[model samples]
Target: MFPLFLWTALLGSAALEGPESRLLCTSPDLSISYSFCGGISHMLSLGVKSCLTKDNTKDDLYLFFVPKRDIIELSVAIQVWFKAVQVAKFTEPLCRGFDDEYSFCGVLKGETINITVPFSYRKFIFPQGQYTVLFEGISGRSNDLIFCVNATVILK
Candidate 1:
């Protein structure tokens, strides 16, 4: 009887098909803007319920926070070398590491609102072969929304 109950609970949780997570948020009334120059673009904002920052003496990051069933999406516009890219990183308080490439904005709600994060990565440098943007999502287990944004400029 206990085994059957456990199986049922597991199945029920699996069936909860929530909204497909997106890397960017584009409401018909909302649009993010940037100033572009020298193969680089600037991010205006990232919408979500998380904290995000970048380590750059010459560059800056624009962050957005949104709520989710379990965690939050930390979206940011990354400027490197002379190019820009948008990426979403998910974080749970219980989790130790960040999951990169969790999702990219591929759908749009309207012509003016894009569901996917925009990226022009031709000018960024990742000296370590890859650069990652990190953030902390809302988690009940931990109140410390310790978010981090880092990129290893690998010029390949």
Candidate 2:
């Protein structure tokens, strides 16, 4: 009977809280489609998938430029057991045509857990007039993760 009570209490507490999530959208000088996923328990990382389309017969040169400075918005959902979740925000410059974007570190019950990670670049340079950009997120805890995702880039 004691074990049943503990299980019920745990399950009840878990049901009280839901997962965390965030939404992001923007327009850029290139066209792209991609997906992002992330997790955090003790570390941080990101993954991206991208594709580009160009008119081969055109003489126009494509230039993709990454932002040197910018701001981002991070959203996260929390569950009951991990109620004390906190998220941190920061920025880093990209290499040439790509910038290193990150999500603010999230903390729950004094433990730094991974949260949503979303990034943006002001101007990116692509070698061709048409290209695709994919931004991705990775995490130390795969099963418990948040994905702050956007999936479209405008053409210049």
Candidate 3:
């Protein structure tokens, strides 16, 4: 059950510089402006999704997601870089993480959900390349867009 707030670090700006400090998806100063993110498509506000910050930083994460419609159910997908292209990796429920303050089972429209909580990430190594993740939600009733966003990250 992947939460919505966990994978949003890729939504951070793309101007990140330097080697160790350049790409900071988990930085509290992270911004949602897609213009900053090279691979992000579509516009989003803030509500759900989880992110795994750099394993060394045991900092509190400020959760944010933007949803622009009344949600009936969630339809989510994940993609990663492959052969110099982005490919679908996973498709699953991303709203299960919003148990306390927000939930997909409920209805929301043109609003944002914000929360701050301390988080820890398991130590793991990523391949040297670019990885992309995408997610979205659609209303089953009216077939309108609820939320949609994607991000790409490069590791050297």
Give me the candidate number with maximum lDDT.
3
Looking at model 3, report the run of 10 residues with the lowest lDDT sum: 31-40
Displacement of residue 131 (Cα, Å) in model 1 is 3.7
Higher TM-score: candidate 1 or 3?
A: 3
Report how far off residue 67 is in candidate 1 (Å): 1.1
lDDT of 1 by residue, 1-156 (tens): 976775674344223312222243222322222221221112113443222212321222334423222333333333332122334334332332355344322211121221333334345433433323323232333553322222222222
In candidate 2 the C-alpha lDDT for residue 113 amounts to 33
Best model per TM-score: 3
Q: Return whichever of 1 and 3 wins on lDDT.
A: 3
Error of 2 at 105 (Å): 1.3
Q: Which ten residues in a row have the lowest lDDT in candidate 1?
A: 35-44
RMSD of 2: 16.9
Instruction: Tell me how far candidate 1 lies from the true structure as C-alpha RMSD in angstroms.
Output: 17.0
Q: Which stretches of candidate 3 lie over 4 Å from their true place?
A: 1-66, 85-88, 94-105, 116-124, 140-143
TM-score list, all predictions: 0.21, 0.24, 0.49
Model 3: per-residue Cα lDDT over 1-156, one tens digit each: 243333343323223311222223433423222221222123333321333445443556454554565554555545554444445567665444246344434546645556565654345455655565444455555555455444445544
